[model samples]
Target chain A: MKEQLYGLITGILFGFLLQRAQVVRYDKQLGALRLCDMTIVKFMPSTILVGMLGVYLLLDLGLAKLSIKATVRKNMGSGLNIQQGRFSLQSQP
Target chain B: MKTILDKGWSPYLAGALSGIILILSVWFTGKYFGASTTFVRSAGLIEKMLNAPRISKMDYFVKKVPKIDWQWMFVVGILIGAVLASASSRIFRWKALPDMWEARFGHSRVKRGMVAFIGGVVAIFGARLAGG
Candidate 1:
């Protein structure tokens, strides 16, 4: 239930940002596909950079822990690779 | 207030806000924010309504049970937020066709709809294939 509520609020903020960025606009999408505009190009990288910085900062501050899955899952067919992060609940002292 | 009421925001601003949201999502849920899988789960849910046995028989469905889960509600929230954003910006409207599409495709609703549907299918297929 708590997770669901978090998902809802997070999605709302995401959707609002998408619309405000105008990436949801048909013109923007088509333009990006045609390589005629850089709206998405600008938006995506900025988002990713900020997200990365924020996440890493949280990690550095011991506010968040990295949950790394195994490199291979036979049932899932694909897996994530976490190269260096501590993939456990233990916090840095 | 003016920025909020504007039809559009600078991509940087919106993108940064999105990043913050992503941070929050990860911090709280220990999961990256993504919507592609939501659509896949929704298809499973819809299919489940019609044919429960077939759904159960499917290996993928067995792994990913179709139900109204967190992601589903997240999608619902997305719809609501989109509506709110459009409404707040005073850009909300009901139109069968977008002006850009009409101009390029000459207002053929059928063509637009078909192309859009196909695009959606291809996009989702790619997203799922890449394990969104």
Candidate 2:
């Protein structure tokens, strides 16, 4: 219940930010895809930097747990091997 | 209100705000932001509803259970937030084909819809394959 509330708040904030940044517009997205607009490029990196710093800080403070798992699947007949990995970090209650 | 709606926040300011929000999200939830997984889960849900037994057997569907998680709520929030923002800005308008699409591909609703649908399908598939 508490976690869902937190998620709701964060999601609202994220959506508001996206709208304010004008990236919700199809043209903005298309322009970014075509390399004609720098809005998304700028917005993404800044968000990544802030998120990374915050996550690391939380980890340092022992407020979060980082779990990483990797799986390797091999196709016997095709001789193809595929590796898939998922990394998740969750806040400690 | 009209003038305000016509103009948007400065890119730098918006970017900074988004960064701050991202930081806050991680600080509170310890989860990264993404919409792809929500899409995958939504597809799984539809498939489950259609044929539960078959969907349940699929590894992908089994691993990513069709449940309304935080990310799903996040997507809902996004839609509501967008509507709120548009309403506040008074720039909310409905149009099937945006100016850019019309200008680039001409005013063909069918064409626009088809292209968008195909693009969305490809993007979702790619995201799933990449395990994003």
Candidate 3:
């Protein structure tokens, strides 16, 4: 219960920041994809830098343990199967 | 200081705050921020309602174990927060087609919906394959 509540609060802050940054806007996303806008590019790097620093600091201090999910791929052929789409549930490695 | 009533904020400021939120999220919960998995779990939850046996047999479902966990609540919170933020900024409105999309792609609701749906599917599929 406590953990769930914390998740909610954290998501709220995240959503708030996303909105305030205007990266959630359709134009901003489209522009970023088209390589015509630097808003998302700028926002993401700053976030990544800070997040990396903070997370590393915590890890170095032994306050948090890193949990990395391994990449798994299964049942995928060498060639792309358009009919099956790029991703398949059966594909895991 | 930008108030809540402001339409938008500096990306740098918002990004910094988001990073702090990310840090705090990890420090307190020992978890990282991710939104895509919530969607996959949601699909699993819905599928479980319709096909319980199939869900059990699926490899991904077995590993993920779809449930309304903390991340799910976090996603719900994200929606609520977005609504609150937009309302506070007095920019909340109902529109099936946004102005920018319409201006670029024209006002064909069907076209817009179809494209958006396809895009969403592709994005979600990629996100899922990449494990969110």
Candidate 4:
């Protein structure tokens, strides 16, 4: 019961934020692709920086437990075949 | 030199709000919110429904995309918010201004949309296949 309530509240808040930030706008997205306006690009580095710090803090406090863990960045090509393996970690030889 | 950003909230506000969305999507859906992935999944579903033989052959189209169709309501909220912001700021006019696309490849909104769609498909497929 507690988990469900947490989810509902969290989803609503997230949705509200996405809408407010213009992240959901087609033009802003397309603009990012074209590099006409890179607010989104600027937004990412800072977002990641903050996220890294927050995650560090959480981990240090033993509060943030990530489930289904894997760290990788995929430079997928498109919608047809969803590829995510461009960059990955491998067992050291 | 005021810009669109000058009119919007501070970066701290935007970033914090976005972080909240990220945290919540993970908590509630057991999934991270990524709009592009869904777009690819949607295309695959459409192609399947149409029995397009080529779709299944593609490296990216074979796998199923995640779902939350009703989640579209969340998207609607986003649209409403953007509209409200633009209107209130009196920046509601659609600017058909020349963009990098127009400069590089000439103008055609249809073409641009198609490129974006194709790009989206390839991007999602690559990311997933690559284990992203």
As for candidate 1, its clashing pairs are none
Off by over 4 Å in 4: A1-38, A53-64, A67-93, B1-7, B24-31, B44-66, B69-81, B94-98, B103-105
List chain B TM-scores, each candidate: 0.89, 0.91, 0.90, 0.55
On a 0 to 100 scale, what is the lDDT of residue B34 in model 4? 41
Ranking by lDDT: 3, 1, 2, 4
The stretch of ten residues in a row with the least summed lDDT in candidate 3 chain B is B1-10
Candidate 3, residues B33-115: lDDT per residue as tens digits? 88888888899999999999999999999999998888998998888888888877777788888887888889899999899
Model 1 over residues A1-93: C-alpha lDDT tens digits?
Answer: 888888888778788878877898888888999999899989999899999999999899887776543433543443222322444433556
Measured by lDDT, the strongest candidate is: 3
Candidate 2 lDDT, tens digit per residue, A12-76? Answer: 87777778778888988989999998888877777777667777787899886553323223243
Q: Using DockQ as the measure, which candidate wins?
A: 3
Per residue, candidate 1 scores C-alpha lDDT tens digits across B22-128 of 88887878767777878878899899989999999999988878876778878888888888888878788889888878887797889988999999999999987
Candidate 2 second chain TM: 0.91
Q: How far out, in Å, is residue B102 in model 1?
A: 1.4
lDDT of each: 0.82, 0.76, 0.84, 0.56
lDDT of 4 at A62: 69
lDDT of 2: 0.76
Return the candidate ranking by TM-score, descending: 3, 1, 2, 4
Question: Model 2: how far is B36 from its true place, Å?
Answer: 1.1
For residues A6-83, what per-residue lDDT tens digits would candidate 3 score against the true structure?
A: 989988888878887888888889899999988999899889999999999999999888766554333244234643
DockQ of model 2, rounded to 2 decimals: 0.39
What is the per-residue lDDT of model 4 for residues B27-81, given as tens digits with 9 covering 90 to 100?
Answer: 4454443444445556677777787677768676655433334333344444555
Specify the poorest-scoring 10-residue window by lDDT in model 1 chain B. B1-10
